[model samples]
Target: MASESPACNICESIISQTIQTDDRKEIQIARHTVNEHFDRLQRELLKELQIIENDKRKEISKILAPVERKEKEIDGLQISLAIIKQHASDLQTFLVSKQIEHELIDTDNLIQSIQNNSELSGVIVSLQTIGMMKSLGNISRFGQTSQSDMSLVRQKIKQAQAKVAVVTKGSLDHQHGTIKTEEGL
Candidate 1:
């Protein structure tokens, strides 16, 4: 058999010390027990490390959950803003069209108003004369002196006489019974 590995100094000393009072192999057996205890402690430390790692993972997931939700919410909000912008643009276009339509209507109304007020073709004037000749006696004759409404009739005749004597061509000649075919200007 191969020569047995020489014992380490500390093991040799433990062997000698224990051998003095106990069995010769008690030191080696006690050393084996210590190694077993160390292995148990190492296993316990590894288990504790695994527990710590699991707790850290749980905590990290908890911290990340809200972050993920907020990120998704931010993305959703951005999309909403983009859609709203399109709607806003459409609304702007609608308002502009309405404004243009209003302007067109206003322009048409203004043109109609301008056309109606031209300073021509205005000749007749009718006056209300309800109680003009109430005290007069009734007279049904045309050009009568005692007519019931003689005052109103006289005023309207005077106004018509003034409007017709405007001398658009010339004044009327004072020829007695002059016919138009026989007259020369």
Candidate 2:
């Protein structure tokens, strides 16, 4: 009976050792499977994160579209404004120059007319007989008339010159104002 008990104890020990070894092998298989599945899950997560990043980039671009369009519009408007300002400056210059040229021509014509009138008056006075002068008009009246005509012509020339100066100054002031506006912009 004692020998049979020893043999049964030995058999129990052997079964325990075999069970532990099987348990260890099962644990290792489970660990290997978990590790492989974890790798696949990590790859899937990385792919999804990349997709999300691409989507976010697309959304950001979509949000900025209107801003980009508005920036282009503002640039176009600025260019148009510059062109308009340049054209206005050109027109103002043309008008001012033309006005000055016309005024100068008018002044020259007035002076020529005055010289012609003075010459005609002198010839008339020199050729006039005393009786004819008396019959027509007094010599003082002729002198006064010629003097008044010459004085009126001189006044007109002076007035035209002053007007030209005023016009030029006004244009210059407008040009300066335009420059200031551009600088501020």
Instruction: Please report, in order, the local distance difference test score of every candidate based on alpha carbons.
Output: 0.55, 0.61
Residue-pair clashes per prediction, in order, are 0, 0
Per-residue error at 86 for model 2, in Å? 10
lDDT of 1 by residue, 113-145 (tens): 545864222333343345644523353432312
Report the C-alpha lDDT of model 2 over 1-185, residue by residue, as the tens digit: 11224544555567667766876787778778869987997798778777776876776566456556655655665555566657778776566556555555655565576567553232211222589657656533321111124445445556666687799999999999999999999
Clashing residue pairs in candidate 1 are: none
Residue 160 in candidate 2 has what lDDT?
62
